[model samples]
Target: MLIASSRPLAAAFDLALVDLDGVAYRGPEPIDHAASSLMAARASGMQLLFVTNNASREPESVATQLSTLGIPAEPDEVMTAAQAAAAVLTRRLAPGARVLVVGGAGLLTAVRAAGFEVVGSAEDKPEAVVQGFAPELGWRELAEAAYAVQRGAWHVVSNLDLTLPNERGLAPGNGSLVAVVRAATGVTPVSAGKPEPTMFTLGAQRAGAHRPLVIGDRLDTDLAGARAAGYPGLHVFTGVSSARDAVLATPDERPSFLGADLRALLVAHRAPERSGDGWWVCGAAAARVVDGRLDLRPEGDRTTTLDLVRAACGAAWEAVDTGSALDPGSIPDLAVHEA
Candidate 1:
């Protein structure tokens, strides 16, 4: 299911819309080889835009964090869901519209920067409500958003990610917080983040990119966003999604390229080929699915485990696409642990 690229990805794509937390860093710590790999891609003339669904932090703050992680970046090179949500509000509401701010400084700053007056409570008769994620958020913010939404105010949210990866583990994301308001108000807010394509489209437009690649760890957000934006997606196994997930990805969530990590950008990607005996082969790795069970083998020569993953995914995807049942248990364990 993967696409072939004779040239290295850094050379093939003019700009890379890269995900932040899971792809580059796990939290306060950096992922292995992420700094070096990204630096190499930049050296190869591929511009990088750090795109994040976490809308709590501003671009300058994010850039500072990346710099501390050894990935030098400019504020302009970062795109946040806050910005996309602001853009969404700007297009729908008139200038100087009163908006109830339900998140932190980032969401407040974006809404204000978009020329909307920020209000704290629904009593202000806010014209709309925009929400994002903030560690300090509590029932008060959710209640305010709910009241505004119930009063027929337009509702916009930065993202709908239920979970967020952090230094400790998975925590509630903006979507989980948004759920509280949705339940109370009976209104589903318009999402302006990943899996919707606005963030990726804005990144490519800002970069002036003719050929942009979306690279990230989560398939649902990053890869799905790419599909929605009509861009190629490269899935890396360094984060939440695993090899098994890739092998079982649905049509809307499948990625165009697979890699162990960001290092995949520096190398050529080989597309899996269908062999005569119905096995899918990539380099020396061959994979086949028989009776809903997956079978993997190393053929003539030694091959990287990632190639085997590609081949396996190809075989499994083809089988699933052709109306054949696939057992999730048949998917191999090819986990790449984060350091």
Candidate 2:
């Protein structure tokens, strides 16, 4: 831990590269304190840069939704995977190059803005196939993409998120659709979304941030991408991952800081310190795995639940670093106590 922040995270980092779905909002609903936290961060002079894998909506649309939710954002402040995938094409294909768009209007607009001619079918002999998430996508679209890839055309997918969250529930994401084309054409697309560090770098550069901290809810994509880009990541439990997921994460998947929501930015983040035999966090809790059983020592005067939670996480992660985590039965103990 880097000397544990005495001040809030809003003052600790110059910018925050945030994820969309899980971090900011779960579909149309806002995560608790997400908007207010972002507003406070911005008020403290920290820049907000939204990095998202959802490619169906345009950046302007995403910003509009954020504004509606009380966190005002501009179109340029949002970076979509479509723009990142389009960047890959700009680096390869020349101007006027035809690329078959297998997603929605956002993707088509990106390719066209990148000086490429958008096509719908392989009959156009597109030089590449760019795929993304769109609700209207079906078997015909996947078949068209497969045909383009089979004809020796390059394939690029905005993201490979298998499940997409919405107002209803988790639905088939672009990754599932990409799998269809992959199975048919036996070709995997070059990914340009989270877990691929390139987009994070681009997002920070766009925001002109010197030291940016990535805040999100997913370990595989948001946290992993931050690590891949040589940046520190803070995990918030507003979506996708749980406390069990964090403590049990592999070396590459571990997060630097953990919190319940975006509001963690407004307070000090004190990482647990080492103690004898196990680890101590917040001076109120001690946890260790003894003979494959997780032992929790709740000290006197446990003031904040978040502090206890942090301590448990620190000890849990320390244990997992050397050995395995305790059984699944102990997972609930680490999970936050909901009211």
Predictions in order: lDDT = 0.91, 0.83
**TM-score for each of the candidates:** 0.97, 0.93
Q: How many residue pairs clash in each candidate at the backbone level?
A: 0, 0
Which candidate's lDDT is highest?
Answer: 1
* Tens digit per residue, CA lDDT, model 2, 58-94: 9999999999999999999999999999998988899
Model 1 misplacement above 4 A = 299-304, 336-339
Model 1, position 308: C-alpha lDDT score = 84
Q: Give lDDT tens digits, candidate 1, residues 1-339.
A: 699999999999999999998899999999998999999999989999999998999899999999999999999999999999999998889999999988877888888899999989999999889999999999988998898899999999999999999989999999999999999988989999999999999999999999999998999999999999999999998888887899899999999998888999999999899999999998888899999999889655544377788899899999999999889898767664321
> Could you give me the TM-score of model 2 versus the true structure?
0.93
Residue 244 error, candidate 1, Å: 1.1
- Tell me the lDDT of candidate 1: 0.91
